[model samples]
Target: MTALAGLLVLVSLAALLWQRQHTLLTYFQQEEYDNTRFFTAWQNVRLFDLRATATIVVALVVIAAGAPFVGVKLALAAALAGIMLIERRYRFKKPLAMTERAKRLLYLSFALTLVLALLTVVHPLWAIVALQLAPVTLVLANMALKPLQTRVNEGYTDQAKAKLARLDPVRIGITGSFGKTTVKHMLAEILEASGSVFYSPGSINTVLGHTRHIRQRLQWSHKYFIAEMGAYGIGSIKRLCDFIHPTYGIVTAIGDAHTERFGSIEAIAQAKSELAEEACLAGGTVVVNIDVMQYEPFQRLKKIYDLRMITVGAEGSDVVVDAQETDGASWRISLHSKLGLIPDVTYDLPLLGAHNVTNSALAVTLSLVIDPEIADQIPYFTKTIAQVPHRLQVLDTPGSALILDDAYNSNEQGFMSAVASMDKLAKKRGGRRILVTPGIAELGLEHDRVHARLGEFCSDRCDTVYVINPSRIPSFAETIDADKVTVVEVPSFAAARAAIAKDLKQKDVVLYENDLPDLLEEKRLL
Candidate 1:
């Protein structure tokens, strides 16, 4: 009976580990396989969850009813709890894909779990303790595999570099706190009018991700390769620049998008300037938004790399944005070249938010800089620019409600711009303005200040606001004028959708400002 109870405890422990591995891997992937971040996120959440606690109680009650011995009862209960956990479904906003890297991490994590389960033979309490320490096992596994992961990354990066050298396409690097992905999409489309352009699709901008794309998709016939460079730390963009060696770099406006990771605006600025610095050192022409030029590090880098610098979107800039006006349907922007290389032009753009106007202008300015001859085709291409998906994208609903899907927006500036657009369109159509948001992420110390400002702005523009994970940004609801506006606090986006279904009326405008991943939206326990 003692031996049988020990065996049952091992079975339950194995089941629990299997279930926990899935969730750990999902967040691990979301954190870009960074063990430090994964561990930090793990620590912030509780160690025990409601389901696990309930399952244990129910299992113990049932086992105690059938088993006479205390040891047998505990063992039977653990076996039953394991059975319950094995069939558990973990919900994630971004489901875990069993990619090659994910598979490797999963395998290594399970192997570590198996070793911990081996201790269950000596005492059943080891299994219970291992349940709480599961997150630590994953962190340890990731840390142990770092050397091997580095080697694998190096191999792929080397292959990508070789392929890039042989093809020798015009490489253009785009980097900023926000709008870099949108600009990459816009430039890729505009440049495609003239030649075969190969831009990194979506936000796949990391070293390994870009390497995979280059290895798999890059062709000899491709004339241009647009690289959207994203940074996790100060040297992150520099690492990518070292890999691609961009001939043209565009620095969009720097902001507090990832200020938490980098710690300060100056660090973010210094990190972004790495692209400009690298591109300039390579004798590459760089187009920078005038806002980025304010940073001291950027100014110093610009002074060093001033030979091939072109400023845009401000007075005395090489590519000047004179005016930006939007009707309810689209935007018409007037821009002129101060350097007189490219012709002055007015862009009729079909996109939302004033930031997009700036994004489009930056894309146009860089496109012309690459080839002044394509200036004639620029206006038509600008007119035909399709709205980037999920970045303030407008969708028509079956009812009179207009859906503005800005689910990918994360910066305060972008959020405010979206709110402004929602207000304008709602008033133009004589409709109620609605907003759904999880607020912004990685704001660090500026989180409260930013959300308070957004709340005040939304109080005027929005009639109905659905604040998801309201506890994450309590200041948002606190600042809103509850008398005039209706603020609904819901746990998940699905809950908000259910509420909206009941109250949505004709001629209503809904803006999903920013959607967070499951890691930020919910508190998960081991």
Candidate 2:
């Protein structure tokens, strides 16, 4: 009986551990295998949440009281069942992908779980520790695989470097705290008028991610390779610049987008300047938004580097956006440049948001730098340029409520713009403006201050606000006018969706501002 019970506990625990592994790996992948972030997220699990704390306490009491009365095997079985219930409560918004790297980590994690489970068989008390080892096991596996991961990454990077040398595509690196991805897509579309353009598809900005795409997809016919670079720290963009060696660089804007990761806004600006420094070194023309030119690092780079600097923005820029007028579903934008690269012209942009006018100007400016002849084709190319999905994308639902999805990667300016867009659409459509968001992430010390401002802005524009993960942004609710706007706090997106679905009416405009990953959305021990 004891032997059978021990085997059952080990087998059942193995299954439970496997389930927990997926949650860990999903976050690990989302964090881009950053061990510090992964472990920090792990440590933040709400282990003492009412339900979890109660489950643990009951299991402990059941084991102590019922061990001698019900016999050790049955008591242990009951405790295991209780722990399994708690594990099952955890459900992630996104599932883990079983990639080659994930599989290696999964294997090592399972092996660690087995070793701990075997000890539980000797004394069931070990089960307590065994079941909670998922995060630790994942950390150990990642630490063990670091050397192999580094070597593999280096191999792919080298191959990509060699391939780029052979093909020699006009490399253009775009980096910003925000708007980089949008600009990459816009530039790729505009450059298509010139020749074949191959961009890092859909935020694949990392060195390895770029290397993988370059190895498999980037070819000889690609006239331009647009790399959208992202940075978590000061040297991150510099390392990517060393990898791609872009001839052209665009700093779209600098803001408090990832101040948590970079430590400060100054650090972020310094990191984004790496692309400009590298582009200047390569003797390539650099296009910068006037917003980014305010940064001291960019000012220093402009003074030191003798590279062509093309500035684009609303005003006082080389490429100046003269005006942006909403024309029903599309926007009519007028852009003129003092640099003479862009001819003064007004073109219809089939995109939403006021910031997109600046984004389009940035792309158009960079596109003209490569080939002056492409200017005549801008009006036609701008018409064909499709809106980047999930970045102020308007969803088509004939009879349903209108949804503006600016949910890809959220920044403060983008969020404000999205809200303003939603309000305008609601007024135009004669409907109530609804805002559903989890708020922005990685703001760190600025979290409350930013959210208060956002809440104040939203209170005026939004008729009703659905705040997902309300605890993360308490100031959002505090600032909101309860009488003017209905503030509904929901624990998860699903809950918010349920509430919205119940109250949704035709002509209502709902703006899904920022969809955070599973890490920010849910915190659980399992």
Candidate 3:
């Protein structure tokens, strides 16, 4: 029995570690901020702390039922209760959206573990492995159930469908690795002048997200619907396209966003372009960024299929935004037509980076068909965009210091834009710029190397740098003065807050670039 207890303890420790990773994974789902916030593994354990307490009761009941050292089991239950109390007292994070479900599942799993532990007295080896995997399996089971549960709420979506049906709206489906979210936002903004529509929150690309948006917020009067569909491999976007059956498809630039699963950029492009294929079958227009080399085949796909491909680029674009560095004008904003006629219209777009010009251009042209009045809203859209709530939001604080919160830049181009945004602010303010980031992750070797170059870019311009995670050691090496850059080891969020509070002083331009989100939520590399 003592030997079994010892083995159980080891298995529990491993389970604790595994749960931490799982917890971090949950927080990472909404990881849109950099140094301002972070997801810690400890929070995972804490959120599921209730399971630990319930497990003791369950264990006690089972052991008592089995008549195996009743007093010891009772004492063990009491000890477990006390330990859980202490654990709850020490835990330091807010309850996440998945907390309630996790608690229920954890309790059930611990009960199972107790049953298995009893079996371990006879079958030791299998029990140990079972104990470690119980909580994980519970989580997986819960995950499997959520989609089914969400689908049952199909009546709400039917109302949305009815409303959209009344409006006779032309729906557009946008999908890609990096720019899909931005593109969706852009499309909504550009199309608002034509008729009423919703942007569907930040990265509302999932099936549930779309379903909820359509079910709840969709109005009968709206003329257009823009849905951003995201996928990991083949058939994923096809599933989404099948659901909405978009009239127009927008394929943003594709890269090695999910190379680990997709195998290569080619595979990623192939997976993403399915939306275009479906849109063509639906007799809908397919708008693609021809500037993207992967879109070269899309240009060809335009000729063969029903796909009406609208291409945008810096040199020759239907709608373009040319830039001049008044203080910081990195992204050019212009308007044109396919016939190569400049519309002599301009927008002071709040969004930075030259790449957004293409994004905005593509959005503007595609939207005009559904929204001819969009031309009037361009200037208003530019002002209201407000940096997409952490994507290059520049704030001028007291004491002559400026803070550009580009917390959502976890992609290759996004990282570059952050560097440029920081430099722009630095040049304007004439103060030292400070970059605080964990750098981007899961971008495969190409993106990792790209981040290293970003480190070099920061080194050239910024005066001080702070990296939240030690995983960016290669980035630190690329720095101008490796010693000058501070590397903070982050195991949890509290430690990160303390470190940032200590380093941040007045009179400095700070750019919190990106924080890598854990997988299971996105096909985007991070």
Candidate 4:
């Protein structure tokens, strides 16, 4: 039985992962790699991979060591069912068109399992021992071979996605530093308001993640597919546009989002503008944000292309939004239409800062071109658009501390905006602002300078500062006097949480700013 279990495990592994290096690598290198999500889904299915395989292996091994017949047979049948069920899970994750390979593999693995079934039929007691040992041994083998998965993944590139975009019927590429997600969500919402829309959810911008998403889940009903292209590298956005082949496009704004990865803002801008260029070559309309400072300054894009031009923001834009802010509480949302004001009324919004308003405005501008009705519907999306999770999400703690969980990985603009918001709120709530931040990262050498500025900015807003990463604290200390800034340095989030956990009082506002990734080379572990 243990031997049978081991064999079943091997068959399942082969069926699911092995002998299909081509398919895996091809999907891995695509621009919109949705395989990361698939990988996550696969991890969920791996439970069965272990249970079925291990149970049969243990049964066989135990039988080899001499176990009961009844136990081994039951385990063998259960293992078989587990294998089938896990494959079913894969089908659920992937679309019918792309799941052919997985389906075929599953069939082959199930056929191999028949050998174990025959073995169990011969001698049940021996089968049980065989199954037991099979699971234990195979589990160790899978663990040992895990590194091969990483190597398999690394071989995938973004070039293939570009190849597909050349064949894409209609591609609408979108890229920017800050508001790609907002524009993606807005475009999806507007398009979905009328016709079938195919857009990836959230920020699945890697090669493997996007390709699998495009291949596995992209529905046939998709007429106008909106893709939000994001980047941390030079050619990432261009590669994605090559895959998407968007006929219509938008670039919201370029800022210091991933300048650390690309080295400079200009490099970042060029990467972002690649979307417009790709759309132009595809004979698609490129919606240029005239309001975005960086893209406008680049200059050359304003001259190139025959007909790929749609101006948005500030100047000669057909669809325009006029915003008038009133005392930091709400902004009047009005759209310029030939028929006149579309929802030309000011409504109170509970959002934190001007960035949210700008994001909504960009949505309105971009949505108007391809989708006019939903362009008018932007005000509604604005009202309904949930504040992005963990970005300025203010909560009331038990002690009534106004806990502002702005822990979503922040940039200079975001951090500054958060500080400004807290300052406004501080004035409104009549309480001193307390900030617990680890400061900004991924700015390369600008880390120290950004930290210094943040420290200076915080000195004006925060009554107390709970610093998380102490190595950057000296840069901050240089910006502000130590006496004015009460800096409590904790080595870890856990420790910071522990120390600051006791500092909350009624009406004390705390901002948790800038959570860093765990993989920093000069990492400080508390």
TM-score for candidate 4, please give it: 0.63
> Per-residue lDDT tens digits of candidate 4, residues 1-526?
6566555544543343222222322222221234343343234323223444455567667778877755655555555555545544431112233343334433343333334444644654433333333323223333444466456544433443543454343456777776666567756765665577776776665556667666655655666667777786778877776555677788877767666678988888888777777777777667665655345433566567633565545544533556676666456656554433232323334567666565665555555555556644455656655566667776765758687778774677778888878777777778777777777655765767777887888788777777775665568756755667677777656667788768666776778876653322123110
lDDT by residue for model 3 (1-526), tens: 6555545444553454344334433443344211122323223223333444455546656665875654544455455444534433332233345544445444554555555555644643434345344545544544554665456556556665566666666788998777887878878776777777765888778665687787777776777788888885688898787678798878778866667557777777778878877887777677777655345456557666722666666555443445554447444456656563333456666666666766776777676655465567677776666456776677776774677777776676777767777776677767667777766655665755666677676666777666654444455445445654544456433355466667566766787776544322122111
Query: Which has the better TM-score: candidate 1, or candidate 3?
Result: 1
Quote the positional error of residue 433 for candidate 3 in Å.
Answer: 1.6
What lDDT does candidate 2 reach at residue 382? 92
TM-score of 1: 0.94
Residue 462 miss distance in model 4 (angstroms)? 1.8
CA lDDT of 122 in candidate 3? 67
lDDT of 2 by residue, 1-526 (tens): 7667666656666666676676677778877788888878776654222332344456557667755533554554555566666766766666677889999998998788778877865765565565566678888999999999889889989999999989999999999889989999999988998999998778888888899999999898999999989897879988998999999989889889888888889999999989998898889988988888778988888788733777777667778886556665677877787657656767778988888888888888888788878778888999988879889899969999998888885788899988998998899889999998999999978888999999999988999999998888899888998989998889888888899998888899999989998778766644
Error of 4 at 399 (Å): 6.8
Order the candidates by lDDT, highest first.
Answer: 1, 2, 3, 4
- For model 2, where is the 10-residue window of minimal lDDT? 47-56
Q: Please state the error at residue 63 of candidate 4 in Å.
A: 44
Query: All candidates' lDDT scores?
Result: 0.83, 0.82, 0.61, 0.58
